[model samples]
Target: MKTGDQTPLICYQEMTRASWRQFRPTTDGHVAAVSVDRRSQLALMDRRPSPSEIYYRPPAGVYWVDVSVHHAMLHLELPTAEGVFAFRAAIDVAWRISDPVRAVKDGVKLCEPIYRPFLERKLRDMSQEFEVGSFADAERHINTYFADRAVDLPSGVAMVRCIVKLAPEDSARNHIQQRTFDRHKAERRNAEHKAHLHGAELQHDWNTTAHGLAMQSLAHGQETAAVEQRHREELEQQRIAHYTSALQTGGIGVLALQLASSPADVSEVVQIMLHQKQLDLESARDVLNTLMEQRLITRRDVQDVMAPISKVIADRLNPTASLAHREPLPELAAPPVGPVGQVEESEGLDEDESDHD
Candidate 1:
C-alpha cells in the first residue's frame, strides 16, 4: 500500500449501528473493527500478525478500536552507581496490540502512551545495577533481558523487541576522563623521579670507583720510585768499594794514572788528592810526571788543578824560593815489575830492537 494510504498503528471511535456504514473498507494490510454485539459471539484470531502490517489499523464501528505493530525510539538519562553519575540511553521499542477488542476495553489508543512508561521503568531498574563507566555492560544486560524473556505489557499489548544503547552523560564522561588523565600523570612523574635517582646512584658509584683506581695508581707509583732509589744507592756503594780496593792494591800513583786516562773522573781525583794527608810531594810529582809522559792530560787541565796547590806546596817547602823560578822536579824512574825471568825476557826484547836498529 502507498504510505499515505496506510492505516495508523491505533484508532478508536464510537458510533450507532446505522452510522457504522460510513467506515472505510478494510484492505489487505488493515483490520476492521467489530461491533460490541458482534464481539461476544466471534472466535479468537490465533494467527500471528504479518510483518507488513506495521501501520495497519482496523476500520471504525460501534465501540470500535484498531491496533497494529508500533515502533518507537526513546531517550532517557538513567542513574547508575547509586546516583553518583548517569548514563544517556536510546531505546528502540517495538510493540503491537495482541488483542484488539481487549485493547479497546482497556481504553488504549496510541501505542506510545502504553509502551513509554513500561520501558522507562524497566530501563531504570536495570541501570541501577551498573556504574556510568560500565555503559557497554549496562546496554548488554538490557538487550539480554529483553531478548531472553518476553515481558508482559498493559492493555493487551505484546512486546516485539527492545534494543538499548547506553553511553555516559557529558558531565560523567568528562569526570572519568579527567581522573584517568590525573592518574597517568602521577604515574609518569613517579617513573621520572625513580629514573633520576637511579642515574644519580650510577654516577656516584662511577665516581667512587674512579677515585679508588686513582689512589691505587698513586700508591703504585710511590712504591716503584722507592725501589728505584734503593737500587741506585746500592750501585753507588758497590762502585765506591771497587775504587777503594783498586787504591789499596795499586797505590795512589797507579790510581792517579787510571783516573787521568778517563777525563770524566778528573774532578773526583783532584778532590781525593786534596783530601789525602798521606800523599807527599814526591808521590804527587810521580803521579803528575807519569800523566805527562803518557800524554793523558792537557796543559790546561794541569794548570787548572795545580795552580791552587802550588802556593800551599811552595809555602811548606822553601819560603825564599819562588816555585815558578825554581828548577823542574827530577824525573823519577819506575821500579821493575814482575819476576827476574820476566825481566830477562824484557832485556832480550831490548837487545833484539838494538840489533834491528
Candidate 2:
C-alpha cells in the first residue's frame, strides 16, 4: 500500500483501430506485432467489442513479444495490531504470452519473479505506515497501488482497480466475539437490576415490621393506663364499702369515731346520713346524738332526725295528742328509762271526797 491518496485508475486501449490498420503495405510491419498480441488479448476478452460498453474481468493481462502479464487474487499473511491475519488481496497485473518467432523469452508474467517479494515488502511498509484497524487507509493504499503502477505493465495492458479484504473466517470470528461480549454485558446488568429490586423489597419489609412494632408499643401503653384507672376506681369503691359497713354494724358510736375528722370524710359522712335502707327509732336517735356530739352535725340536724320517731312514740302513748302542730321539745332530760319515759298512778286519791256527802 502507498502512503498517499489514490488517484483514478488509468486504462488504455489494447490496440486502437488506427494502429491496427496502419501501414497496410508492409507485410512484416505493425500489423504483425498487433495481430499476435491482439489474438491473445481477444481470446482473453472472450466477447465481441461493443461501441459503448467495455467490461474487464479477473486475471487482466497483456502480451507483447514474449511478455505475458496477469493479475489474480493473492493471499497474504498480514501482521496487524489484532495479530497476524490472512489478508486476501485481489491485484491486477500486466502479464505476457509465449512468442518464439521474436526469440525474446524473459519473464513468465509481465514482471520478474521477484515481483511478489516486492509486493510483500510494499505490504509490510504499508503495515507500518498505517494502523492495523484503519480500513480506509488500507483501501486507499491498494487503490493507489493499482493507479500508480499500471504504467509499469507491458506496453499492451492496463489495470482498472484493486482492493483488499479479510479472509472469510476472520470476519466471522470478529462478529461472534463482539456479539458474545455484548450478551455478557447485558446479563451482568440484568443481575444487578434484580439485586437492586431485592434490596428494595427487603428494606420495605423491615420498615413495615418496625412500624408495626411501634404501633404495638403505643397500644400497650394505652392498655396499661386503662387498667390502672380501673384499679383506682375499684379501690375507691372498696373504701366506701368499708365506711358503710362500720356505720351499719356499730350505730352512732362507730359513726362518731369515723367522723372525728370530717373534712377528709365529707362524702362518706353524707352517704352515712342518707343511708336509711334499714333503721329503728333507737338506732336513729343513737346515730343522731353521736353525730351532734362529734360536731359533724348541729343540734338542729339531730332534732330533725328524731322528730318523726318522737311523734310516733307520742301517738302510741296518747292518741289524742296533736303532735303535728306541737311546740319544739327540749332535749331529753336524760337517756330513756325502761322501754320509754313514763309515770305511774298515785295510791291515795281521797275517793272523790267521801262520796260528795
Candidate 3:
C-alpha cells in the first residue's frame, strides 16, 4: 500500500457494483482499512473491514477506504459569559478513526472536520460559563474536560488528547485593559484625597497646639508683670512706713540726720523749727538776757554748748563722719540751741519784730 500526504480518511478507490477492487496496507502499516459496499451497504452496516496485506486482497464490488490518526490544530471562537465578547481558543487534537466502516459510509474525507465541530459545540457550551477575562481558567477547564474523557465525535473519529490554549479576542482584550486603567485611576484619586484630608487634619492640630502655647505664654507674661507690680508696691509701702516711723518716733532731729546731707539743709531745718515755735529776735534776746542775768549760763558756756551742738549736727549730716550712723544728738542740760547771736534774723522776722512791740 502507498500513503500520501492526504487526510486521515482516504479513499484509495471506488468501484462499480459488478467489478472487483483490490488494495494493500499503507506503507506505514498504521492505517486501518475498510470495505464499503455501496449497493447492499452490508459491510458498512456490519462494521467490516477489507483484507489489507501485501499477500491478501480485498473483494470486488467494494469501495476501498483508509483510516489513520491525524494531528490537527483547530482554532475556534468560543462564546463566553459576555455575549458580545468571545474567547479565541487553539486546540491541538489527536484523533483517530473509531469506526472505519462508519467513516466510509458517511463519506468522511477528513478526521479534523469530524471531531472539530463536535468539540466546538461542546467547548462553546463550556466556555459560556466564564467571561473573556477568565481565559486561564477557561483553558484549564477545556484541557480537563478533554483529558482522558470520551467525546462523542461524528463519523467514527475519536478524541485522544486535546491541549487547549484560550485567550480573549482583540476587542475583549482592549476592554479589559481600559477597565483596569479606570480602576487604577479611581484608586489613585481616592488615595490622594485621603492624603489631603490627613494633611489638613495635621495642620489643624498644629495650629491648635500653637495657639494654646501662645495663650499660655501670654498668661505667664501677665502673671509675671502682676507679680513685679506687687513687689514694687510692697517696696513703696515699706519706704513710706520707714519715713513715717522716723518722723513720729525720732522727731525733726532724726529726720535731719536721715535727710540732711549738708550744713545748709540743717540750717534750713533749724529756721523752719524756729518759725514754727513763733520765736522772733526780741524773744531770743530776752531769753539770752535772762540767762546772762541769772548767771545760769555764761557767754562762754553758751558758746561751749553751741560748739558741741554744731559739731554733732555736722557729724550727723556728713556721710563720711565717724558718727554718721550714730544717734542724732546727745541729751543736753538745756533745750536744743544753736548760735543765737550769730544767727541773723531774716527780713520777715525783722518785720515781725517791729510788729511785736
Best by TM-score: 3
TM-score of candidate 1 relative to the true fold: 0.46
TM-scores, each model vs. reference: 0.46, 0.30, 0.48
Give the better candidate number (1 or 3) by TM-score: 3
lDDT of 3 by residue, 220-331 (tens): 9999999999998997676456556754464656665545544444444433433433344335546765665564664445665556645654443442344355334332
Candidate 3 lDDT at 350 equals: 46
List candidate 2 segments past 4 Å from native. 1-71, 82-109, 112-119, 125-160, 168-357
- Mark the regions of model 3 whose C-alpha exceeds 4 Å error after superposition: 1-5, 8-29, 33-69, 98-108, 132-155, 166-174, 219-357
Which sequence of candidate numbers ranks them by lDDT, best first?
Answer: 3, 1, 2
Worst 10 residues of 1 by lDDT: 331-340
lDDT of 2 by residue, 45-96 (tens): 2233454322323222322332223444556655544454434445444322
Tell me how far the alpha carbon of residue 30 in candidate 2 is from the true structure, in angstroms, after superposition. 14
Q: State which candidate, 1 or 2, has the greater lDDT.
A: 1
Query: Model 2, 281: alpha-carbon shift in Å?
Result: 19
Backbone Cα, N, C clashes tallied per candidate: 1, 9, 1
**Which candidate tops lDDT?**
3
